[model samples]
Target: MKSESLWFIFINASLINNFVLAYFLGICPFLGVSAKMETATKMGGAVTFVMLISSMCAYGIHALLVAVNAPFLQLISYIVVIASTVQLVEMFIKKISPTLFRALGIFLPLITTNCAILGLALFQTNKGYGFIESFVYALGAGAGFTLALVLIAGLREQLEFAEVPNTVKGTALTLLIAGILSLTFMGFSGLGS
Candidate 1:
């Protein structure tokens, strides 16, 4: 397979076709864990690790399935890989820092179901990425997720100080901000062209 440049894959995945902003995958963690910068950063790191691991596993499994003519198992296999990866991350976090584990709470386990993780595996396969391409794509997706999370967390933190009318406060304001951010990310669509 002819491979695209690594830089192109990285930029396209992270900026142009962002999993959260562009594809709208993994909105749960994007909204839930992004309330604080510290939590967001940790969530991002954990996601990145899982994405990389799952991407690699998906690539290998895809090849095997194709070789054996069992492509029907793609989705199930990918989910298994992602779930196992999230479990590892959960245990590691619990052992290293109980405080962070508590803060992350259910979201850490929820990562197993985060469409973003499954999406990474599916997208890489759909794009026919090689092993290296899959790895870079995962890295880029993770970075994009982190970028969006951090930006929202920062904005939410600032919103705490802003005096706003009661009608437009709370989730209404957050959804508005998220919509604006998603539109802003749309500007990068031309980058891939």
Candidate 2:
């Protein structure tokens, strides 16, 4: 039964309902950090990595909350745990791979503030997902995020060569493109229904 629920959560998190296009979470990065293809890809990978870690940590914390009968602390605890974990991951990345650190440094800390990461943690608790379920959900969500970011970045890179209007030069163009992408994702609304 629990195994079935985990599969359901993973599928829901990935394709049926994605964090960006479906839930509209993490739009800041979606629009702001998606200018350059290389940077955007790096940012997506960094976010996915953080999301998985944060999800696992949040699940463990949720278990502790259930044990202590203080589920009310779930929100605060999850945020703290996610932030700290991002920090640790940032440091480890810096130490392990200086090139990756340089590519992802600016975006690494930003993941701490990304609403999607926090939202994933909160939603996992709200949905009462267990350890494996939460892990799979996080992985699926991260993949969804990466897919969205990479696709948008690729489009934006192509748009660079196109003759976009001056009024929609930078942010305006990106937002318009994102709006279109969101509509495209709407086609997947019935994917797992």
TM-score of each: 0.96, 0.90
Please give the range of 10 consecutive residues that has the lowest summed lDDT in model 2. Answer: 1-10
Q: Model 1, range 63-99, lDDT digits (tens) per residue?
A: 9999999999999998998899999999999999999
Q: What lDDT would each prediction earn against the true structure?
A: 0.92, 0.83
In model 2, what are the clashing residue pairs, if there are any?
A: none
The residue-by-residue lDDT of candidate 2 on 1-193, one tens digit each, is 3546666777788777889988988888887778778877777877888888888988888778889999789888888988888888888888888887886656778788899999998887788787888889899898888888988999988988999678879888887887888888888777666
Judge candidate 1 against the unseen true structure and give its global Cα lDDT, from 0 to 1: 0.92
Clash totals for all candidate models: 0, 0
Once fitted onto the true fold, the runs of candidate 2 whose alpha carbons sit more than 4 angstroms away are 1-7
Taking all chains together, the TM-score of candidate 2 against the true structure is: 0.90
